[model samples]
Target chain A: MKTIKQISVFSENRPGKLEKVTKVLADNGINIRAITIASSEKFGVIKFLVDRTQAALDLLKQQGFTVAQNEIMAIEISDEPGGLHRLADLLARKKVNIENASGFVIEASKKAVILVEAADIEQAKSELQNEGLRFLSEEEIIQ
Target chain B: MFWDKKIETISRSGLERLQLKRLKSTLAGINKNVPFYKDKLKKLKIKPDKIRNLEEIRNLPFTTREDLRANYPYGLLAVSLDHVVRLHTSSGTTGKPKAILFSRKDIEQAADLIARCLVMTGMKKNEVFQNMMSYGMFTGGLVMHYGAEKVGLLVIPAGPGNTDRQISLMQDFKSNAIHITPSFALYLADVLEKKGVDPRKDLFLKRAYMGAEPYTEATRNKIEAIYGIDVYNSYGLSEMNGPGVAFECPEKNGMHIWEDNFLVELVDPKTNGPVPEGKEGELVLTTLCREAMPIIRYRTGDLTSIIPGKCRCGRTHRRVSRMTGRTDDMFIVRGVNIFPQQIERVLMAIQGVGRNYQITLDSLDDMTVKVEIRKELFDGKVDHLVNLQNTITEKLRDEIMVRPRVELLEPGALPPSEGKAKRVLDNRTL
Candidate 1:
């Protein structure tokens, strides 16, 4: 079963400040898989899914970066429109609630991987697979 | 020649040495023209050139924000208003808005300084830069916009708001950089996500230069990770030239001040004496480049320090640490100096009180403090609002010497902040 590791990297909203956070992950050879920023002009909350989830979390936390570990869903869907909607609808049908969803495409003409914080990960994955939705591997996201 | 001098090379040292000269000239000018300074300086028996170095400079009476208010519109300007090319005024906590003046040179210098800061953070020439800082009246937008333009970068004058247009420009023109407050940047990111567009992959943003309010390290990482770019810290005051006094270099550790253009002083906020290097003190600035209104030992009220060193980025000019806090931020809650941040720290510690909070002084009454906490109260299941409030009030009373009337507001009801969230409202009529 593939899983998504939501790695939180603490940073200030000033320039070159982000370099410190990304540098830690890059320095430790942890590859960033998917990233999306929830930020205001003054501050931001950066969420990342990396290759070595536990290592990245430990390193960032030890470095005094307030990193939190949360489980996110690694959902695979067809590369066409409404693919996301169908997968979400399937999860809803199974009563699997998505708290937040974000992801990136592997490449052109392939499935798009999404990282979702759902109420129930096992139920979500089971429902999606039952609905014929393809789940992506953690290796593919890091690649 | 100015560019060769590390102090003059977009860094802050050149500005500081230059401030000495400006401080002298401005003091002399003020003594000759401005009635208040003329009286004060003469009474203190301080002559123009004699007021040299830090010790002598301290003897000179400091300029305060209250002084600016007392002076009102024109009294603060050292040069005539005709020489003043523009004006930016924000309503202070006082009845009348505090006003600041800038000459053509002053504006150009500020813009040029900002331009250097832009390039320092990897802003390429002709890159389509979108300035989301508020335009007009607010100095943030125009100063940076001109600065980017001065550096020959393509500018998108997408002021503030108008989310659709900003998105369309990002999609169409492919903007490379943006200058906005951190909150607005997050908001734009949200809009981009809502539009089903990934900002990192689609947009060409290489930088998000943000400042105006203090933000946590968490915010910085979030902005950079989402946008996939560098975020630079820029610090300045409307009293001084806005947005270009000091800026963070590519090294990302601390901010370098353009010391040649502005004499930067770090004084014990209370004593008005120089604080030790690297020590936090009220940042008082002397503008060496302003033709319209050159301020001398003008207390910025904003707290920071003179880093005093050569930066790894090879800039010899001195740098200042990120603005830690402000001096006048102190609130006399029941006759004790209480910084809202102290209260905020306590409030954030409690799960019941959400982020947004307001502390107001009841004027018509006995000048009692009423704290309105707007939070995600329902999220906490401990029936803890009253207990949490009581705990906070007790902590505040112990720390700040005052009891607060804690009124809890529903989540998202307090005024949503686009810039620095105003945390306090002094309802007391002075």
Candidate 2:
């Protein structure tokens, strides 16, 4: 079972915060493989899949930023139409709630990877793999 | 280890005898020297000779903050203006600022009294003392400053609000003791950890004198554990010569009021009469030895009780428990009286609640308490977070007897303050 480390940063919903956060990771030579922002009216949480997970976590924490890291599942799927719908249908049948998710195309018009955060990561990973979906390793996601 | 053993260790009978003598002299001094007290005494048909015993103090009228405010600059002075040595004014965050006068003798005595308190708390003359309370008219700063100096400690008058400099000064001077407000102590603890200065390994702070605002005992324990220091609860107000009126001895049971310089009394705030011993009441005080402006029966709004037991330190001065709350600090929600300290006590006892919080009373029907959940406890699950919020609400309801809507805010969402942290906001129309 392979797992990818995802970093979540708690940030206030102020202008230019996202810029500052990306600047911290960029300056520290960490590449953001996938990213998403979950925001409310007053604040937001920025989720990132970075190449150097621990380094990015430490740098953000050293800058007085609240950061947390968790092991999440990253699956590579077909980039064709209904790619996400098929996976969603499979997880829905199994009642796997996707607490948070983000995806980006790795190979244009052919392949893509979806990062998922579920309440039970192991359960979701095993159920998705049993349905013949391919999972990406940490190194493969970084590459 | 005692600073003034003869005065501090006097027996109960001996203390009463001295109080009576000083009370007579003070009554005489005010009746003859100040026309305000003279007129009040004459109106009450009371004579200086009438106060022959300590029990007769009940006959005297209470001198309230309003009276102090009405007198303003010099109306309450018991001595001539030429003899007034120094002056310190209340912060006056609410109404007209009060001016407190101190003669040269008053200054020396206040320093001596505070020195005695420091010594009682296990502070020594050889240790380095850093004064972090604000200076300039805020009595907490200069009063403790003079007292630490008198105790023969190396004084670092590092005023509040510069956290890095405060830490560096402690490192530079190797300061072993500090005088600061309790809220600022919590803020400093946060800053110290952010700077990676583990107090146990990097600093030499062993003693802390915290007062000027009400704090829960849980707060005291948190500060002590964070820095590995003995944080003593200090009690005082500018009217009673600030920061030296009462302090905790080494036993940490309760703060011993130095009854030699000031006469302490506990009274029912509503009836303005004495309460039974060991009961919560308003703290009333009379300046016994003050020559410049000896206030009589000054009603301190702080609410506390006299602890029932004697201190193990052998000091004969009676001890007062930690101030629970101020009479003015209580707010009504659905006809239930709630104190901010009550909420604080409940929050501090919980595992995940952080130091900073805000209580906003929206109306009699709606009250909300905003707290910061510690970052470590934020598991990023909405249901888990809701459970934590419900737990806090239930705990607070159980403690304060009022159910308040609890909102869990992110870390650092609340405002940062170095002085008294404003914790309550009453947004009710009524």
Candidate 3:
């Protein structure tokens, strides 16, 4: 398993705010490998796994967006009916709390990568490793 | 202890009699000396002789800021330029500034009135007074300076800004009294706390005169708690010879208007007529004793109300409540008249809201407001933030009669203003 820097940006929950943030990252040639939005009534936190994490964070911060970085483990699991459940069950057994998480299939019908944000990411990783799980590296995700 | 006991404590009938005498003379003087007033009166078919009593003031037309700007430099001066000893001007945001002239006698009277307010606030000759307002054409600085000198106080003419020097002066010289605006006073309170100087012990600040802007009672309480001093509200304008027009006495209930100098009226701004007694409306004032530039029936554009009773301080002059906001500052959003003070009241009542906020009106297809929330409220809980926004939105709709978009910003994200806090930003061209 590999821990990647997941950048979370706080923005106004209004039209064009998301577009504005994405446009700034896109203009700077930052590729979004995986993205998920957790929104409330007034604001939204957009979590991103990008090809250039530091560049994306710096650019968004320069544009006056509140940005933060968190370490999360990205795992590649079998693209089966119980893929997410299996990962959740392992984390729960070890008393690891999942703060947030998102996943997508890179190779359809075979394998999928789920980005898991846990309270103690290292503990989550060690436990997952003890259970014989495989993680997608930064090189693999960018490619 | 009364500066002008005979005048200040006169009976209401006696005061009105004196006011009528001064009003008649002022009316005749302006009609004979100033062409603008002469023309305005002639067009309205009004004559100085027609004013039988003080109540006849209603027959005269109101003088607005537009009228003053149209005249520009010396259009409203009743006396010649050589006799005009000093001049002050309004900051004309939309057009030309209105120039106010003061004769030597007018300056002395103004100083005397300011000294009367000072004495009412317990300013003594033994105490050192520090003036912390801008000393240029703005009337707040020099007006208080002249009054402090008149009252025989050792006045330190410390102009505004430079908080370090101000704190040092207060510490070194044991300055017991100060004159400052409410906003600057709040900022200075923070600086003083950070410098580790306890205002109650390390410093000798006893009384403060706050004016030049409208502030809430909560803000006054905050400043008082920070400085451990008595804060008095001083109200005036350049057109009315500055900071002596009215003042709060020991009671601190309402500011007493100097009826001998200013004839005050509360009128419905839209209809230009009187409102019910003690009802809030636009303040309309007429200078009774001014010689150089006697503005008759001048509309101040400030919203306040006459207290309708005598102050407990034994001053016979009628008092007016603290000003809430300006008529010109009111903006119409979604066909609803909204005052910034209404929104401020709502925001201040809510917990976790910061002292600073900005209301921006944007016009894309329809007019919408964007309210910036403080950063401290963002505790990283997305659900809590959403609930807070929705609560504010619902409360704003209930309070201001309009729903606005809320955006939570980092602390100190909004731009800081130099002088007054720019509260509203209307980007709508229409």
Candidate 4:
């Protein structure tokens, strides 16, 4: 079972919030692989999968941004109509509650990888591996 | 026309003479009974009998809130507990509150002064007075109640809150006047508007005494327009016997400090020396008539100036302008004195709170404290952040005695101050 580290940055829901967060990462030469935002009325949390995970977390924290690092499992699925549906059905059957998720399609490989954050990440990794699913490692995601 | 016409209209020469004699007696009483004052006076090598004129008051040491808190419960009282008939406490900077002791004569004198204030504002015996200020340990309610009762007004002892009930009482009893805070009065006016109750037509309120908190003249005008009644400003602190320390007569000009009871001095907050006459400075007062506990040259922290010359109302007691600002970081929210340090203490004790925070006061007197969330505290869970916000709110409420809306912001969201940070943003017109 392989896992990738994801950095979550707490941000107030106001104008230029995302720009500030992204500017910090870009200024430090940290490339963001994938980004998603979970927001409420007053504030939001930005989840980022960057190439340099530890460096991004350290830099963000040093810049006085409220940031946290957590392990998330990124699973590769076939790039087709039922790709996400089939994976979702299996996770639903296996009782792997996905707390948050986001994905990006790779046109060259004709495959899509879904980033899954769950409380029981170890259990999800093992259960998905038992079903013969391919999971991306931190190095593979960075590449 | 006055509660104590002779005293209220005393000539400048006579008032000075009275103030000098009373100041001497106050010094003598505290010198003999209160060790705190006795020790302070002895260190200055001053005798009460040697104090001849009002100018000599500057020779006395200034008493501060810290001094009052250091003395605590009974340290400042000039008389014994057997002679003290009543006690009241107001919020202090720390956990311990400032206690004020009142002897039987002290209470009577307080009531008489309030009665004088009431009559000066045109309150009569037949008018129904609704006291909406808090009772119990807070002096606003009881002090105003005793005074209104002394004036023979049909006094209603309705404490603050329950806007519906307060309005209903005003309607049922035909309350002719009310003693309320400016913030609460605005809230009540909003409630009346929502209920489609026109105050002018549906109520019998002719005037209002708004005190215990600072407000602007524009706010007074707005409230007066809403209720169609004259809104008078009342100024007082518990140290100098609440709400009747100074009051506006029908002139609606600056409030006249009842010089017969309390000696008022305006001094530079930083220098502790008298500012030039009629200049804005911190208000320092001495309890000239109090028997049990006489605070001499007590620093009030409120910034105001003396309105030069006599008021057209014929009261010789000098007028002090409405408070401009505080010399310290203390702010009154919903009529509760709150120091930014009190909020900071609670935040600093908490585990996840960051160093920078700002207290914003809205026009309606609602306080919102925006605290920076520490980087380590963000665990990618909104529930955790919400819980942290609630915890800060509860702790601040316990410490400051006022519930504030706590906001968790990203670290560095608040503007970092270059040198001395402005921690408080008071948006209220006051």
Q: What is the C-alpha RMSD of each candidate to the true structure, in Å?
A: 16.0, 3.0, 6.8, 16.3
Instruction: Pick out the ten consecutive residues of candidate 4 chain B with the lowest summed lDDT.
Output: B412-421
Question: How are the candidates ranked when ordered by lDDT, highest leading?
Answer: 2, 4, 3, 1
TM-score of each: 0.64, 0.90, 0.76, 0.61
Winner of 3 and 4 under DockQ: 4
> Each model: TM-score of chain B?
0.80, 0.98, 0.92, 0.79
In order of TM-score, best first, we have 2, 3, 1, 4
Candidate 1 lDDT, B1-430, residue by residue in tens: 1223344454444444566677777777777777888888889888886765644776778788888888888887777767888988755554776788888988888887887787777777768898888888877888888888888888988887777788888779888877777666765775676577898888877887888766545566678888899898888778877887888888888887776676667888766678988788988877777777767788887777777667777765678887766665666655666676666655555554544566776643322323333221322211234455568778766655666666544333456556556667876655
Candidate 2's C-alpha runs over 4 A off are A12-33, A37-44, A76-98, A102-114, A122-133, A139-143, B360-368, B402-410, B425-430
> What lDDT tens digits, residue by residue, belong to model 2 across residues B1-430?
7999998899999999999999999999999988888988999999988777898888887898888998889988988888998899985447898889999999999999999998887788789999999898989999999999898999999988888899999999999999888888888887887778999899999989999889999999999999899999889999888888999988999899988787888999888878877999999999999999999999888899999877889999999999999877888888888888999999999987888899998778778898887887665554455667789989998988888888777667788768777889987776
Residues B183-247, candidate 3, lDDT per residue (tens digit)? Answer: 67866765665567788789888988988877777777767877889999989988888887989
lDDT for position B154 in model 4: 93
Say which candidate scores most in DockQ.
4
Off by over 4 Å in 1: A1-143, B1-19, B52-54, B328-415, B425-430
By DockQ, the candidates rank as 4, 2, 3, 1
Per-residue error for B365 in candidate 3, Å, reads 7.6
What stretches of model 4 exceed 4 Å from their correct place?
A: A1-143, B329-430
* Tens digits of per-residue lDDT for model 4, B99-157: 99999999999999999999988888888999999999889999999988989989999
Task: Say which candidate scores most in TM-score.
Answer: 2
